[model samples]
Target: MDLREYSVFDIMGPVMIGPSSSHTAGAARLAKIARQIAGDDVKEVQFILYDSFANTYKGHGTDKALVAGIIGIDPDDERLSHSFELAKEQNISFSFVKSDKDASHPNTVRMVIKNKSGDVIEVLGSSIGGGNVVLKEINGMSVEFTGEYETLITKHIDKPGIIAMVTKVLSEHMINIAFMRVYRQLKGDMAIMVIESDQTIPEDVRIRIEHIDGIEKAIVVDSINKA
Candidate 1:
């Protein structure tokens, strides 16, 4: 193993309320990020659990963790244990269903969330042990990003110069890009750009990026594990 790529926290694990790191802490983080991606007006949520997550969720506290996350509770929050009550109090309905479909990871879940506006979003993610997680898909578009950075997501028309123009705006703001990915379902169609930056992109900068021609939406997810 390349020890250089691992931090002390990777070995020691995160400070969280957990009986199992993958099922509890990681599940919470994954659901929390999914909630963030889906926006705050979420009215209802359905968790389609797969593989190990499906087999052992309730026993391992993954059920509570996932509920806690959808209601904006963090893994380390003391309220994690009572997330179901909190969700009911907040009027956010949720359910968990086990799936027999094959998953890429043992701890995987697909979140189908509906907002009060009736808009729905689907997000797929996995907890890869050690309280670490990765979001793999958004609204059926393939994506890959850990919620460890101040990440920016943009949905826009797939056209020439779009990426360059967006990058130029970030460059002007002196935001260093740690990672960037672009995905489209077909040629000359809608596309999604995922950018993980070393520094937080200011709201003004994000607004400028969104105003660019062909850009539909620019959403930023603040770093969950800020260094």
Candidate 2:
């Protein structure tokens, strides 16, 4: 059936496993997607919930669902109820914060995840409804993605001509950039680049990016489609 045929209430009403579909199921899915983007072997996580999520998370099991997802629990698993104790047993550290931002979505969540290697990543996402979500930002870029693309997330020194240099390599190799976003922390000194593409980045291109003058690091996030 075409999703558009369903009314918002019709779509959201059948999802009755939680306190609120947007707050609970959507929150769980958002956390799961963030975990997928952050990769496995995560050692720690921090979840910040906004507005409605903040107010009802504990009662709705949104907190447990988020924690369960980071600990690698499947969303439909009955073990989600024990996720916190499981995390403690597994030695995975986690914390929660509530942010009441007037500008944020009611079901928005910001997750900071750290892998065992101490590499850190931050993802901002929102659960729209019917257990659906969109990753709105990563590392401060205004990006709209579903965590289903082969990706490269990089941080570099911001400078003129960097885009041409990177795109040149892809163009030379016949790779297509499906989506690209750049976030600048300072005018010309610090920036992050997140690129989702139609093909896997070759090892040679990865090495070449590391050698580029203004680039700091070019790390390929594993294919979300494959994961």
Candidate 3:
């Protein structure tokens, strides 16, 4: 098997807070995604760890890493060690659960997050050996995207022409779609769309997507090219 050229940081080292990149950095990234999926102010959080993460998280500062992220700390910052006190200051309650079942990846975490509005969302992510992470699922739907690009997430009624409507708007705005994935439990039910693009998605595009006839909710989950 041939190994593709990986990132230089992954090869040498990731200038991060904790000792383990997979547990600490990956856990923090999941928190940033939690903010993206839930909102900035998280009221409650539950992290489910499987495989290696379940056994050694406490020693690696993984728990603190997760708490730091949920409370708005940057993953690379050194303050990740004090995440517990910070989370207490923020009044955000968090819990951890170790899973006995096997996961596709060795370092996987599933989070159940709730926002200030009492809206709860489930996010599944995996730390792929580097400081890099991949968001694998949302709620129960399958999705795959790394936060390296601008991403758009929409929850809509599963029906015809919605894709056309959304993409048309992006096309009009000259946004280049790098990757896209759609997940739905069944036909004619709730659907979720994840579209990663090469440019910053404007607020207008997100609003427009929500306005489409079949769309129920729309939001941009992008971090690239932000001021």
Best by lDDT: 1
Each prediction's whole-model lDDT (CA): 0.92, 0.76, 0.84
By TM-score, the better pick of 1 and 2 is: 1
Off by over 4 Å in 3: 1-13, 224-227
Model 3 lDDT per residue over 43-145, tens place: 9999999998899989988889888877877778878899898888888899999999999898888889988889898989888866778888888888888
TM-score of each: 0.95, 0.70, 0.90
Least accurate 10 contiguous residues by lDDT in model 1: 1-10
Give one digit per residue, the lDDT tens place, for model 2 in 33-139.
Answer: 67766766778999988887888889989998888778766555667778999989988899999987843577888999998889887989987776666788876
Error of 3 at 105 (Å): 1.4
TM-score of 2: 0.70
Error of 2 at 54 (Å): 1.1
Candidate 1 runs further than 4 Å off: none
Candidate 3, run of 10 with poorest lDDT? 218-227
Whichever of 1 and 3 has more lDDT, that candidate is 1
